[model samples]
Target: MQKAQRLLDLAALLLRAAEPVSWREIQEQFPEDYGGSEEAAIRKFERDKAELLELGIPVRWLQGDEDLPAGYLIDKDDFYLPDLKLPPEDLALLYLSGSAALAGGDFPYARDLAHALEKLSFAARGPGASEAAGQAARTLSAGDGPGRGEVPSMLEELSRAIAAQKRVHLVYAGAERSETTERDVDPYGLYQAGGAWFLCGHCHLRGAVRTFHLARIRSLEVNRAQPRSRDFQVPPDFSVADLATREAWEYAVHPPERARVRLDGPVSAEDRASFGPRAELREEPGGATVELTVTNGEALLRHVLALGDRAELLAPVRLRRRAGTILSELARRVR
Candidate 1:
């Protein structure tokens, strides 16, 4: 039998044994693999045991009492993962995120990630787990889109660079300009936003911190000189959260204006938080009115439109007029 297969069978036999499996039993199970001289067979077993230990499976030897014989066995508790009693909503989000990463085709560890998600689903217990898993699976399949053109190998390289605090050179496509430029960046971290992967880093070309979309990175090369050493240190004050949590409307394209918006229905705390930190809320009978500084009028208008009839832009007459004009145009298109 092949060494890999023999090792697998050995592990299975030890795991399934109610009591410690004797060495004689293991040899009998794989006679061919253990049929050489006694010393040679023992040497082979030792090698297999070492390999299993490296794989995180310890083959423990039991010193039996008078009744039980001395043997080897695998503790199920040691081999198996503990049950993660995650709430249904949290589990669903994990499932969705994993599925999205796989679907995006940019994540390098696709096979390993799939196995992990399977294990996550299996380890999930408690009420509503099955329902949540099912819902998440359905949601992922329903929303599956055409595969993106981003390279998975590049993403893998970037991940390595981030972990090692290494610098990278990139041929990046500009969003506004129809051109690509060479950039030398010290990568800090990678984040997912709006179903896309972005790299947050210190750009040498811009002489500042910048975020680059993974898809927009035409090509990249990690600084390979002194590969074992770190290229730069991430600043103590810099945080990926500050950049990742920013909403589209928070990206200042125009001068800031105090925009008032009325939410005429039940507003979730999450919704309120999306209005940003500067937002002031005044609660009324049925709903609440919010006043916040807006910098991206187009993004704010789009956000209000997504909320359907529940949200209305009350102040900033210019933006209100633009929203009205967009609605009118949309109505015309539909008709």
Candidate 2:
């Protein structure tokens, strides 16, 4: 069984235990698995405890209190999920929605939602928690979709830090400067915009909320030794969408200005979507012109370059000339 499934089983057994159950009893119940030679069982149990703690599940060992022998169980009060009062029908609908999203790979919070659904399934199915848990896991892990090929290690780490309300230090490469700098960030949330993932957080270095592209984050380490309590609190009204409004060239830290680009053919859905709603399109004799408010000159130039002969930079005389000079240099080099 996967460790996740085994952990769920362990949680169930502990939650239902009327009193602290001894290690020997736990061994007897899970022989060939949790049950083993005395030393092996103890070590295995210790590892399991660490995993549960890491996931925010509280497991406590009660030292032979009263007349009872020392043993382990999840804190019943802490583990008790608030009654959501959703009937089986409601839960089934949620399960279907979650499963479809996972299969389609469009879900931004796939990992987080998958775990929540598993726990919810356990709560909703009651006596059938085992089957429901397994089903939920299978559904969410159906396939490796786009951007899911390598299992976004940094994204996972950031998600955990967000949940734990921990501060993190990031070794980030500046997009335009190509300089690496370390910054301490208090992550508020992770968001997916267009085709990329970004972390919205408070940057101590910048003294502001900044969006860091996941691809640009060279490394991250959570500041676990700060203190027992959380180092920062996301303002109650804070939202990731607030910081995610910038697009393409708009991400450049510069005064924004409008620029026009002419395309030789109809805009593709992919291109139109990437430009977002801020762009205005006007039809021309042979093609179309798109007006965009840009903050990053190079970003706009890069996009136009990617489109090759299909795109032309118009107006913003300076930017257009810059694009032309670069193109001319490329032509000479290739010749």
Candidate 3:
């Protein structure tokens, strides 16, 4: 029998057995695979056991007593996930998020995520649950982009390093520079923004925390020393949420300046909250004015431009003039 078939058969046997299965019973069931010299058979079984453990199926051994025989069995409770009992709406939201992550085929573990979504679909017991999930999947898949070559492997390696708390050495191409530089980083976490994956870590080269775009990582190596032990600890105060929520204008590119914008159209609560907590808002007739600190004036300009007539830059005379020049250039191009 193939190793995969043998493993599956063994798992099924153990899961359904009323009591722990004896070594003799296992040997009898898979004599072709388990039958050999005593040492060889035992080694084979040990290898299979390790593989099972790696697959998250723990095959536990039980000690024989006067009345009970020594054997092995898979604890059902340990193998099966508990019912989450999520409502249909929440399940739909989860399906949407998962589908979005997999849409472009860029995620390294897309197969694993697809399997998880299948399991999640099985758990949808409420009325219209499956329909909701299907709708969400359709919405996300419609916008799928071409696969990102090589980025998947880099992401996978960084994910493993992050989980193992191992530092990584990287050959990175800077966004603003032509030359590539080598750096050692202790990866804190990974996040996706603007459809690109980024690794947030402490860079020994810069002696500070920095974010590296996965596409720009030309090469990398995770520390191999002490394979079973962690090489570093993530700082307690470090939060991926803070980094994920930052807007383009918030990046530290230029000297910080207070900028104001007037919103003429009715703003949704969600839109208002998009401005960080540091923003101050004042309500006026027919609209509101918001003042917030910005470090990238061009980013702020683009944001206002995207909002069209609904938003207007109100302060920092230099940016206002720059916006006008950009608008004029855009008009000239269209004309």
Candidate 4:
């Protein structure tokens, strides 16, 4: 439950209590197993009390009462939880931050993400979580990311397309180029990127695969969806982590390889900035093998080539040839 909602429960407890409760009386309500410092308990009371008030709970201090400087209570009617009207920026920030966490492989933290996503998704679905989500969309422009408008807007369309089982012709632009492709997509789900938004869906054109980086889509159109002969789904082994890319580069690499390379001295902090966190590194017997999930004959090879003797491509015959060709070209240039 959200802190806001949980505070509602606590306020209800106080309102139903027979008498005005002192801070100590409130602290004793928790089970003995909920052990913590006296100060911590008091601080929790203080914070939750304020939050409850913000929720329109009429929790307040009892004034002019001897030995009850911090006594608190609420009338049953005055203690009701108030509706919240969150601005769009807050909603966007909340969702983006949550989605990014799940995208980073922190599954344990997904519930919090799920909860926030639920609030927004539910608000968009019907009247359960709050009217804030609906009001939020109209209130704020861009919250955290300069590109946040893409998510709330695209998500509305994406969800509709999913339910109708329709195809959305998307205009996508990236390092590849700008072009529109009509994708009969079964929008399986949407997940967070590094503070960005992505939609995972099976593309009819690809036959069987998931795609992402919905924000980069410059244009989108909905069309009547063709029915699937078989039930379509993302592979069980597939995960958001596997599809993570800042630039929307989902193109398959040439092939997998075990490339060994030696780092000269310590790796520069500046160089570390280039290889993303997903790029794992293992120290080999002699040097190190930066375990990379890269395609064969990609720019990574050129990177290894640029490293000179400092790096050696030690796996995949395809990378070997590409390295050899690059080195041979470098030799000719040296002449």
Candidate 5:
């Protein structure tokens, strides 16, 4: 059976079951989808359950009634949504937002967003919900440009490895490196920012925690030599976002030093928020100055450059000079 059909069947079976259905029953009902050894069936079920959860279907494994063994079922009360009473405009906005994000194609979880939107559309029984959703989707479709290329398959493989806590071996092509090299990595987490995906993990080769751009990974393979259960573990308090911000130089970096940048004029709340918590904002009648610490000078430089004439590097006269030289080179090229 096709995977999509199997998923629908599994959901239907779970939703209709009055008591927890045993694993055996599930296997029997979808023999073509889950047939094989018990272990294979279990793995299949696990993947199906994950897909169901991603679709907003609450598939739960719990203790069964007297004769039934513990298995899976959907709690209809919780699985279904109450009437939202959302006006047509609001529903249209939700549809448009989802459609835009779907078109943007940079979100790490973009693949699941469509499924989520479908569930939301079904739940929205408020007046004019159907018409609102249809209009929103139509408006978005009409405005969208050519669709983005599909995300690399490696991203999906890495996601599974992260979920399974499996160690991976990668041939990485770092920007500064002369040649690609192999390393074993225990992925702590994944992040998406600035339209790129990054994997944060402990690298066996570097003997340090590092963030790797997904595009820079030339190849990836699971390290089967290491027992899955015995693989490296991520610290409970470890934060992917904090690591990303620091590594990306969006926040304080190693051997941090203060950076002061002058905003062109009338700095907005967004301008202040861009520097993260480590920044201090000084407001003036004309504009504003922001002081923040950074570890990666190059990343900071790139960020300031991207802001165009709206911002300028003030402190660290050396960086300011470097920025000036870059701007001059750019001007010459454009001419």
Candidate 6:
């Protein structure tokens, strides 16, 4: 079976075609990277057409010639799917989720998403239908979410700074630390995982876009004199999933060999959920051992903090030393 491509690619192909295209014409646009024969291509095309049609792209069967018949082509003007908009069918789901977010008072963005849903739902729904949607939404969010809050607003602030090429100064207080340290930043971008916000920025102190925790930001202000450069671009070497994991250590930069860690039973599921995609895990006596290469010391530290007592870094003498430092500080703070 063949999987259809993203509609954006198909739209670009269709727009470039000179005339009404047959199935073969569409097939030619398939990149060599996508392995499929003409017949296989047609199957994928049909699926793609269906998906596009669902999203309101005007792909249809053209009236046939009296001569030997040809297949369909997308309408020239309507070949592309409109901007990303949830269909009427999806609006119901969005309302339910948004309603829950509103009830919890955690996600402020939910109010905006809900308003957008209301506009769509009004057009699609019948009378009294919206009332039912509200009730269903309430039921879905009955359980409380213990996940960290304030992440969304922090991401918003970082995003603004990145767009405006602005510098921001903030006081960061670490999990175990008593005092706050002020850092001036060249804001690069924001990223998220597991309900946490990370500000990727050139920390004036560190002289790099070292990831900073939104939770640790005790105070914030923008610097007016030292604006960001228009040419600044984030490197492609890092990512959200890599920088946020639940093991004793997790990071993306490929090291000489992936550092290995052994985790006890209690935090095994938590560890697996965050780092399992990158981890090569092996079952050990008490729990599981996970292996991964890392470059971001901050991400690794965060992972260690997540496990608290359940994780043990197996190899790399430097990591053990860092772990000792963290534990020593934690010990002092607790007792």
Q: Which candidate's TM-score is highest?
A: 3
For all candidates, the clash counts are: 0, 0, 0, 2, 0, 1
Instruction: State the lDDT of candidate 1 residue by residue for 23-116, as single tens digits.
Output: 8988998889998899999999998998887566889999999887889999999888667777877766776777776655666444455556
Instruction: Note the residue pairs that clash in candidate 1.
Output: none
Give per-model TM-scores. 0.58, 0.56, 0.69, 0.42, 0.65, 0.44
Report the number of the highest-lDDT candidate: 3
- Name the candidate, 4 or 6, with the larger lDDT value: 6
TM for candidate 4 is 0.42
**Of candidates 6 and 5, the better by TM-score:** 5
RMSD values for the candidates in order, in angstroms, are 8.4, 10.0, 5.6, 16.0, 6.4, 14.6
Candidate 4's C-alpha runs over 4 A off are 1-179, 190-198, 212-216, 222-238, 245-255, 268-287, 291-295, 303-311, 316-321, 327-335
Per-residue lDDT of model 4, residues 82-146, tens digit only: 33456666655655655554444322223333544545563433232243343333333323345
Instruction: State in Å the error of residue 42, model 4.
Output: 45
The stretch of ten residues in a row with the least summed lDDT in candidate 3 is 139-148
Q: Of the pair 1 and 2, which is ahead by lDDT?
A: 1
lDDT of 3 by residue, 1-335 (tens): 99999999999999999899999889999989999897999999998998888777899999989987899999898777557688767766776777776665566455456556666656565544465456445534544344535787677677788877999999999999999999999999998887888999999999999999998999999999987588888999999879877888999999999999998747767556666677898888888898999998889888888888888898899989988898999999999
lDDT string for model 6 (252-328, tens) is 45444556677887554657766657667878787887777765554665676667677877666777778888889
Candidate 3 Cα deviation (angstroms), residue 22: 10
lDDT on C-alpha atoms for all candidate structures: 0.81, 0.77, 0.82, 0.58, 0.75, 0.62
Give the clash total for candidate 2. Answer: 0
TM-score of 2: 0.56
Please estimate how well model 1 matches the true structure, expressed as its whole-model Cα lDDT: 0.81
Q: Deviation in angstroms for 293 in model 2?
A: 1.9
Q: Tell me how far candidate 1 lies from the true structure as C-alpha RMSD in angstroms.
A: 8.4
Candidate 2 residue-wise lDDT, 118-223, digit = tens: 8775367544445445655874676445655432657667777887789999999998988899999999998877667888899999999888888888888898
Better of 3 and 6 by lDDT: 3
